[model samples]
Target: MSSVSVNIASKVQLVLRVALILVIFGWILDIPGYFGKYYYTEQLLALVAGLAATITLTDPRWGRTPARATISLVLGLTVFIAFGYVSVRYPSLQLELASAPPGAVALGLLMVLGILEAARRQTGIFLPLLLLALVLFSMFIGPKLPDGFQTRELSFSRLSVYLALDTNALFSKILDIAAITVAPFIVFGFLLNAFGGSAVFSDLAAKLVGKYTGGPAKVSVVGSAAFGMVSGSAVANVVAVGSVSIPMMARAGYARHVAAAIEAVASTGGQLVPPIMGASAFLMAELLEMPYRDVALAAILPSLLFYAALMLAVDFEARRLKIGGTSDRLELPAQNSDAPDKHRWRYLIPVGILIYLLFFANRTAGSAGLWSAISIIAVHLIGPPAQIWHRLQDVWKGLLQSAAAISDIIILASAAGLIIGVLNLTGIAFQITLQMLAISGGDVGIMLLLTAGLSILLGLGMPTVGVYVLLATLAAPALIELGIQPIAAHMYVLYFGMVSMITPPIAIASFAAATVAAVSPWRTSFASLKVGAGVYLVPVAFVTQPELLLDGTLLETATALTRTLMGIGLLTLAAIGHMSRPIPLPVRIIAGLLAVANVLPVSALPQLGMAAVAACSLAILAWAAVPARTTPSLKHENT
Candidate 1:
């Protein structure tokens, strides 16, 4: 494409992005509260937003395919609208297969297909494929099937009726969470990123962590964690933070792949972290009818522990190679480097208000987000606040940042909708759960491995949130039935869902990081698995001691927290392959064994063993610290 055409295409894409962001969030938020008490508008809006997302994400290098795009978009909008509108508008008839028209039946299939395509474009094909498998089962399953696998019958009209009327299965609790909390938080993230809230955090992290060892990578982790708290999406975290941190890490002497992978993996961790975990936790609460805090509580330790592992791994690699910090000669820039210091405070105005809302005020997440945005922009634009026009421009830019992630969100909703609808029709969700349970032979460890594999499979072509939400719906029941606490059951699925992101063949985060790092994506992904191995152990940790999830008395929680911290420190050292200077491979392996024992559970022999290994590693490192006569304090390690 010529530069002019490319420029035009870019402009068009940006405009479409902004428009879809507004439509989706507006619909997702259901801002038309009074205007549309009717169900049709809501479903129709969802369809439009989903299609817009697919269109927006298409590689513009192919040029516009207006006819094809519009057809796909409209076909999708029609199906969902008909199902939602008709089912609500004619509920009695929708439930009666004999009374429904052929057009209505066609509409149902369209709704399923349209949603599948939207998901296919925005996420990957896994969800759509899964949804299709179940839908086809509903189409063909006859008598002689297992009890749970058998549905009412296989006629198109009958199947469509089941999908449309079964509100419990299709539109379920996820939509409720989406409307009440998740969507607003998504918008909150977008607005925060667009204006300058994230920029503020970046500037803050650079100042604080950038002066330390492994400064760039550490800064990425710290800044990404802070930013991830509100951003909601992992990939979005990369786009927002990686744009700045990746280049800086490379310039600071880290390999480009390592730099990018650090950002990607760190950003991915955001979905697991609180106060704003990947929109899934909120959905989990809604699904289980549990308190939101319950979800956050369960997630806390595991998130801290994962990042702890990451920090140690990165620090070790940096030290082993003696990668020095950025030349202090190049003085770091100020937070508001391009502007006056006065604007620095303006950025905090919003964040301060958000913190108060999230922590002390104890407001609903949606209300907190809305008010936070209002306060920042409103306070900044008052007569004494600042120039009204200038602040508006800044806020607008900030809002656009939020807009950019819309395509992915819409795709997620439609994809989730498809799975819910299809499985509801075939009763396949229950069957899948039952079969997996039977296969696992009632062992919790075996059940977890099965579900973990399932979660990863689901995650392969979908958003992490979409993946877990579906798995939690289908597979979590088996665990919950086996006496796993509702919270632990959901969290077990969530942990593996996150683990899937780091694992190939999907490895979305690793792939994103690889682009900036200049490392092969596969190699970086393998590195991710080794670094993120701690995550695999954490789900079991929480299950074994819910205290780690803050379920017990404060004292119990404290013990778990302390042990968790110790485990993290030990594991970090083990992962870095050093206690002091580089350890021999055998010693490193020995240290790894001791660290595992230390992290696993407290015991006299294992504790002594841990102490012995750590002490030995520390001693060796201490001796290395005493450099020979004129040798530099640092020495590089060979790869």
Candidate 2:
């Protein structure tokens, strides 16, 4: 704890961060032959980096005592490096490590414990506990379970080795995608943040929507979406944009809880945004063996509908409350300050290039991310710097941030691998699918509802990537088994997985935003649920009609898109209990039912019946939504 030890600990942490970043870059771009040629080596390196970073960043002991912190780092680094070197040097050991030899089992158990500890350190106990429960199930419970859930008996040694040394266990597809694809995008996002991209996004959003009703809230929506496109974490997005937008909304006459809810819900949707959606997108592409671009493209319509619904709610609320214009306390610094207009253009260049390469050139997401990052850094370096020292400091800070971001992703992905490994080993996913089908009586609707419930339960207290990975492995297959389109099924879970961030009882993004807005977390959470209501129905819409996912003819897609958008608008109006006028309770109930009916595919209901019902619903909504006459609409009781 002395000054000298404190300096040494700081230096060690910094060095570890830089090393982690370098390793990620080498693995992503294949600059070093060793990283690209050896998959296990890269995976081991990621594990080591993640553990070191987690201890340095999250462990409280590290801050309290320099000696303990240094010792922890040194020990973690040494064990990981030794294991990695041995694994790399002796490929045959991977198979042998799974055998029942005492030494091998001991090493495997230690590695498994290490991975769980790392996961616990970064995330909460939920995910690590889930994985541990699965391990226990496979060893003790699974073998005894009858019929559908039965599995072969395995001893502790074999189970430990299978999870630790087997390719499918600790280093599975989730880890693969995280390392190869998501890491680069994560780095790019933090890099963008480090170089004033937040200011640029805020300024641009304000200029675009600052004059409209609820302009500040709209800015939060637009800015959060833009930032979410690059970053995957809802909590991180809330922190980055909510700090600015929440206060802006509060200053513009929005209540504290409402402001917090708006930012939380808006930021939560960012993971669903395209180009660089949450890490789930990359994992989906990898699992489906399709291009990442395809996953992103399919997400476009739903994402648009999501933002449109949020914007509409904001507009309607602003009108209802008579709130408008920029706040006197909320001036945009990037626009008003000496920061040149041309400087803002710097933000667009990398984004433009990223889109061009991702969609037009058909480059891999990782490659696109690398080029985009290079473009961003290049522009910053080439531009005039007020001081060389300041530029160096900025670059240094960006590097450390990028390292931390990548490490979080690596750890989450690595931990998720255990879930995948256990399920595959026990064939539990298949058993669960069959059980679900049986319970639902082969009804697709019931099956979807069950799957969604499971998705939410499993996704809670986990990051978007971890949630999607777990659900995709266990729940998504059930939906697919029910004849749902593969993309639709995966996207269904993806939506719910990200939705957990704002879902009540444990909304991480809402908690973070509430802290920033200084509002009650519970109130902000419920408010966010209301703000995000329409989006909650999107997954069901896509499940019922695949056209909503762009999996149909042009005409079919357009018709579905239009109807779905209208359904979303109507549902949102009902949720808010306001349109042009306050809808009566009966009318709101009717509108809500109508919205669901409108979103349902004709196959679910007779085509003629659906059309008639939709028409009636639309007419009723339009009539009820018309503004009431102000003074003499109804005769007074006195009269």
TM per candidate comes to: 0.82, 0.93
The clash tally of candidate 2 reads 0
In model 2, pairs of residues that clash are none
Q: What is candidate 1's lDDT per residue for 1-639, written digit by digit as tens? A: 455545655665566556555654565456777586545543543444443444443435344465544454445445545544543555454345456677656755565565566566666667767766766766666334766556645666766644533445334455445544665576666555544456566667667767767877777787888788778767767766777787887777777777777777788888878766778887887777766666776788888877877777677667766665542221222221334434645657766776678667877666766677677666445443445566577667665545545445555655576567666555667677888888988877688778888888877746678878788778889988777787888888887887677788878888877765667988878777756655556676676567777788999778666555555555555555553375567655655554444444333346566567556545444553452354444443331
Query: In model 2, how large is the Cα lDDT of residue 160?
Result: 74
Best-performing candidate as measured by TM-score: 2
Q: What is the C-alpha lDDT of each candidate?
A: 0.64, 0.76
- State the lDDT of candidate 2 residue by residue for 150-218, as single tens digits: 976777777777776676877676776776677778777777777766567666777888788888888
Regions of candidate 1 where Cα sits further than 4 Å from its true position: 1-99, 141-153, 325-342, 379-387, 393-404, 595-639
